[model samples]
Structures are given as C-alpha cells and as structure tokens.
Target: MRKSPLWIASFLLLLLVQTSGLWAQSAKKASYRNNNEVRTVQGCEYEVLKGLAEITEVEKTRSKSESALGYDEYSVKFKFTPMEKGQQLMADFGENSFDFFLRSGYDRLPVGPKYLKHYYVHKGQKFAMEFLQTDDKTCREQYTYKSMGIPNDLFEAQDSIKAYKIQIAAEKLYKKEKEVNEAKGIAMAEDAATQASGNRPPETAPEEQPKEEEGPKEEEPLDEEDPKEEEPEVDLNLPSEEELRKKVEAELREKEGLKKSPDEMDLDALRAQIEKEERAKAKAEAAKQAELDQKNAIKREKQAAKERKKLEEQRRKEIKAKEEELRDELAEKLAAEKAALEARKAAIREQVTNEIRRESCVYDEKISGTIKVISVEEGPTEVESLFGYKEYVVTLKFKPDNYADLPRKERKLWDKTFTFKLDPKGKSANPGATYVRIHKLFKGNKYNGFAQRLSSGVCNDIMVYSPDLPIDASQVRK
Candidate 1:
C-alpha cells in the first residue's frame, strides 16, 4: 500500500499531544529498559518513564480471576516467533492506545496484527523523529533528528488497519456483480424454455370412423378344413415396425446433424440452445430495425430543411416588397411638401414689396426711447403734422458720473438734462435719391443702403435723418 509522508506526520502529531511527556532518545545500538523488564529490538529502544507500552506475544483469552476486567479476552490472536537477541528485531503484535502508541525511548507500535508498521527501529535504517528534539550542542542538531538517521526516541510507526478494512470492503463489493450476473443468466434461460414450449401447435382432431352394415351371415362350422386351401398366399409388401424405427433415427442424424436424439437431451442443454437461438434472432431483428430507422431519420431531416428554405425565401420576398412601397411613399410625400412650401414663400415676398411702394416716405416719425431728456416733451397728436409726417420731441434727463461724491445741495443743481428729437422713420433728405424709402432708415437713423455702409464700414448713431442736421449750439433753436 502507498502512503504519504504527511499522513505519517499527522499521526505522530496527534500521538504526541495525547500521550503527554515520554522522554524518547535514539542511537544506532541501544535497548529498551522498563524497570525490571528490559527488551532489546534491533539497536534503538524505548526507556519508559511510565507504563505506556508492552512487548509480548498474542494468545487465546484466558479465564480471568474475579474482580479483574476481562479486556484481553477480546484482543486479536497473533502468530509470531520471537527473533534471536538483537537480530534485526521487529514487533509482530502490539495493541496501541489510540491506533499507534509511542514513547520517548522506543518506536510507537500499531494495534492488532501489524504493529511497528514499516519497522520503527532497526540498525542503520534512515527515519524521522517528531515533537521536540534532543540536546546535541549545535542549533540545527538540537532542532532536528540525527543526521544519518532518526534516533529511537524520535521515530514513529504507522497504523495500517484503515487500509486493511478498505481492502476487505472492496473485495466484497467486487464479487457482488458476478453473483448477480449468474442469477440473471439462469432466469433468462428458464424464460426461453417456457416460451418455446408454449409456441408449439396444438394436437389435431382424430378422423371419424364409418359404421359396418348388418347384412353378413354368421360363422359356419364346415369352413375349418378348407381354410388353408381357400386363402392362397396373398403377399403384403409393407415394412416392419423395427425398419420404421431405424428409418426415423437415420433421418434425424443425417438430415439435422444432431448427435443426440430429441428425447435424450437434458433439460439444461435444451433450454440453453433455445435461449441462444432466440438471442440470435432478436439481435438480427434489432439490426434490421435500426437500418430502417436511420433511413426515416435522414428523410425527415431533408424534408424539414427544404421546407425551412422555402419559408425563408417567401419571407425575404415579402420584406423586399414592403421596403419598396415605403421608399416610394416617402419620396412622393417629400415632393408634394416641397412644392407647397415654395409657393407660400413667393406670395409673402410679393405682399411685402407692395406695402413698401404704397406707404412711400414719411419724415420726422419717431419711436419712444430713453436718454438725458430734461427739457421738454411733445407729441404729434398735440403739435399737428409738419411736412406730412408726425413730429415728436423728448427731454433728456442728466445723470451724474458718481452721485455719492457730491453734496446734497450741489447734487440737485448738477442733475440737469437737455432736449432732442429722435426720428425713427425718415424719407431721403435729397429728393433726387429715388431709391431712398421710409423703411431704409433704422432705429439709430442709419440708412439701410449699400452706398452708406460701403463708404465707411460703420452705421452712424444719428437720430435725425436730415443730411444738414447740426450739433453746434448756434444752430439750435435757443
């Protein structure tokens, strides 16, 4: 059996923790000394601090004295021959405390049959030690086992009972299938014989006999002497009974090649032959049925593929037609919308041209605005028309740069304003410029003409549209 080193180490670790302290030491040649009993096995041995292990042979249970527990009665019976003193000794029997037991001096022994599994101590054998180390001066030597090998106190033996139990269980399980198969074979053979006997044709009905007529006379007493002469040799050439029997046997042997007669065959052989023939026939039928099934499967798959392809083609055609219809509809709708939009834009352009021509030019027309208008305010409704256009004037209010710096008295004086007129709509000042229209001047009185902007790339901020308008105080109507 195979074993891992980790398994042995784990076993040793558990053993050390449970058994408490047992001072174990190792040497190439040594003996186990336990009080009065001193046992030597190979070179290394166990020096017991307590009564932990025993070296003895296994025997049948003996009658125990009263008051004593009969524990040894249930122990395993072992067969062993003790080795000569110090001749590569190995323990054949040991009932460990828990699986395998060890002490500080000698190796741990396994319970039952195989104790000291994979020998704990033998002269010059390499092995390992566990738990703690011995004092050997150097730091490495103190922590580890002997360099060439493990000392007797360090080495541990394994327990093989688990492996043995598993092997036995496996053996039992292995034989179970064969037993089942044999039983199944017998049952199958019996069934074949029963069915064979049942399938034979039933016995046919016996032929019917005709009744004799009652016209014949009774036997005469004078015919006894003439009996031999009357019936002159009528020869019948039919075969004898023995010949018929021989003929049947010859036919059976020659025609069917059967060495044994039908009645002579034993029940078991007859049943076995019947089962074998039935099995052969069943196998043949299964093979034939499989072939037919394969053909049908292939036929169905091909038909399904053909139908799938046809359906896919039909769907593709429908999608293509729908796409064409949608494309044409979209194009026609877009064309009609474009035509209607262009016609509407043309009508609006014509109406705007007519309005500009009919209204003509109007001068001195103003829109409301904000400025420093402190002087006066006038409206076209009160002043009446001047030159066929409304005249409106406004006063501008003065605002200081920084009101916070001025005294209250001086602030009122400085808060004065001027008056000016803003002509929002104006006609050309030069009547010769026929292109000038009322709408050409913007809110700042800047003319919306190409010549005005082309001369200087700036729109003038003039409120009065007249070309001769003045800003000098002398030109004002003071």
Candidate 2:
C-alpha cells in the first residue's frame, strides 16, 4: 500500500498529542510529595499537596468580577490536622492567581477576597474549593466594564496537557520558595555536623551555601569553649511550604504595580498633620464648654431671686388677713353688751309704773251707821189708791271700824233713842265712808234716795277697800 505525505503528517501529529497527555497525567500524580505531612502556614496548621492545576471541566458560568477566569478553573483541597478557633489563614495559589480565599465557613468577618491580611477561621474547619477568579490587572479595571454590558476576559483559554499562564507563574514562584527553604535546612544540618566534630572554627551564624562532597574527618579533642556551644531553637515565624508559595505570589503582585504605594517618608508626614488637627479641636471644645457653663449660672441666680420675692409677698398677705379678723371679732362683742344693758333698764321702768297706778285709786274711811226699826204699818195694795206710805223712828250711832262686828244690844245702847225704820223701796247705808245716798228737794216736792252725794275728784267717789275688811268707818259726817 502507498501512503500520501499529507496523510503521514496527520498521523504523526495525532500520535504526538496522545503521548503528551499521558506524560502530563503521570507528572501530576508524582508531584504531591508532602501531601499528608502537617505544616504551619501563616499562624494556622494544615496539610498541603503541590501539583499542577488540572482543568477537569469547562462550562459556561456567570460572575460579577472578571468573567469566570476565562471559563477555566482549578479544584484545590485542604485539610487541617487538628483545627482550632480564631486562627489566621493564608495560602499561595501560585503566581497566575495572585489572590486566594477560604471557602465553607469564614465569609462574614471583614476582608473577603485577598491581597491583605486578617481572616479569622471558624472552629474545626477545612476547605476543598474550586477557584475561577480574576487576575489582579483585570480586577483593577472595572471602574468601567459593566458585568451586564460585556464580560471582560481574565485570561485566555488553557491547553489540556499543561497549566494556564497565571497558574504556571504561581507554580514557579512556589518552587523557587521551596528551593530557598531547602537550602537553609541543608546549611543548618551541615553546621551542626561541623560542631559535632568538636573543633570550633567560628561563632558566626551558618551560611546557606551550595552543597559539596566531603571526606570523613577524624574526631578532634574538645576545646575549652566547645562544651558551651548550643544549636539555636527552631524559628516560629518561618513560612511553611504553603506560606512560601503565597509569599512569592505577594512579591510578584507588588511588582506588577497595579497602584502607587507610599514609601516611609510620605507616611511620616501624614502622621504629623493628623496630630496637629487633633490638638486644635481639643482647645476649641474647652472654650465652648466654659461659655455654656456661665450662661447656666446666670439663669440659676435669676430664678432664686424670683422665688424670694414670691415668698415675701405671701408672708405680708397672711399678716394683713389676721389683723382684719381680730377687728371684726371686737365689733361683734361690743354690740352684744349694749343690747343686754337696754333690756335691764326696760324691766325697772315697768315696775315703777305699776306701783303709781295702785296708789291713785285708794281712799280713807269717813262715815258710820247702824240698821234699826221703829214701827209696823200697812200700805196700799190697790191701783189708783192713796199714795202708799210707811214711817219709822230714826237713830244715829258711832259704830266705827273696830266696833262693826259687835252685838245688836251693844249697838242699840250706843245709839241715840229714836225710831229709824224707812220705806222698803228707800236706799240704805253700807256703814262706810266711800259713798252715800241722801234726801233732796225736787220740783216742788220732797224726795229721798237721791243720786250719790258728791264727787271725790278724778276717781269720782272713793272706795277705801282694805285687805282684811272690805268697808271701814269714816270720821267725816254729812
């Protein structure tokens, strides 16, 4: 069979591709030398495995920063041998991706992305995450490129057989750091071996020099100062393999010069200006506080004076009210005393008037008489007959007040001897001096039993009535 030259060339190209793919896969497997070993990086303890980043899958994905790292990503895993709380973590993802982040627990306590310090990890936490992040130069540009407008490419697409350019840069940085640490370790080991030979050469620190072949040296006797020599303790600040990788990445990022950084002299000037402004502010605050205090003191003094005036007015009003009350009480008491004295005077005047009225009607006794019979005669009993007449003897006697209750015989013996009987219709004497009826001449005829004899003034006839005897003898005679 005859083969064309073009067909032969195509077969050769395909064979070369398959061979390279196998070589890369085997290389990746062999690269993780310290995969299970515990090491401390950036104040945190963890295990790291170094290998070329494998592009396992490719698919369309969305992002707000630098567009899916050009649709290529690496899945890196990590394990903490014994995790603890509040540990600061940092890792070097290589020079291609200058920035790295922790996934799964610590996202909330401030610095989220990369390039600065301060990530306080969660309790007992580890991460195995895929990174499809922007390169440092592209992330700096979105002061313009909108995510919705058009996606900015962080990198070009990568080949299946090898890593992306950013990742290759990172790998070279990590390998260089590893070389440096290995050199330091070797130099220290050699220095210690030299000391064990017991012949002290110098006291300077060991140098990190190139390795050389040496023949066995015989043991020498100990010098005077050889026993005092001591190897230095291990350094806590030395970067582990993982931290060395990140430290290299940080150096490369700084060199890219994304933004201008201030040097030591500029920082010093900024510090001094801040201090000057603070001092001026403190002086102004003190003056403002003093002015406010003075205003408050004046207000308090005015208030106290107003209160004193109010109290003085109240005291004066109370004194005036008490004096008026006392004057009213005095007026009421004087009016009552005047009324009592007037009532006593009226009673005395009534008693005197009654005594004068009683004295006006009294009289003295004046005349006395005794009753006597002279003869018995008959008088007419028919109409139109001769006028009837009867006659009796008369007598007068001294039967005074003391002698009024005597016997008739004694009275007769005292009387003048004469018949003194009068007509039955004639008036008789009461043997008192108060009033009497007597004979009088009338119109050519003589009659007796006339109206009372005479007047006794304002009371007419007197009635001298006594308490013990109703009638008394009068000394006056008719």
Q: In terms of TM-score, which candidate is strongest? A: 1
Consecutive 10-residue window with the lowest summed lDDT within model 1: 448-457
For model 1 the TM-score comes to 0.22
Q: What is the lDDT of candidate 2?
A: 0.37
Candidate 2: regions farther than 4 A off: 1-280, 330-478
The TM-score measured for candidate 2 stands at 0.15
lDDT of 2 by residue, 1-478 (tens): 6645544554555456445543433322211122343333222233332222222222223332433233323322223211332221233333232212212111111111221112222322233332222212212110111121112222233221133333433444456556766898999999999889897668898888998989899899766666678978987887799989978777876889533345524666767788778878877887887788788878887887788788878877887887788778877776766665565456445434533443344334443432222322232232211122222122322233435577888555444432221211112112211122232111122111111111322232322222222222231122
lDDT of 1 by residue, 1-478 (tens): 8535544554555457335423232242233322322322322332212111222333334333311222112132221222233321223223321112222332322222222333443222322222112222222122111112222332222233344334433444445545656888999999998998875788899988988878888877664475456666867987899999988888988888887766887989789999999999999999999998999999999999999999999989988998899889988988877775665456445534543442343322332222332332234431222222333343334334455677999567445543333221222111111111332311233221110111221112223223333222222221
Models 1 onward score TM values of 0.22, 0.15
Top of the candidates by lDDT: 1
Off by over 4 Å in 1: 1-264, 336-364, 367-478
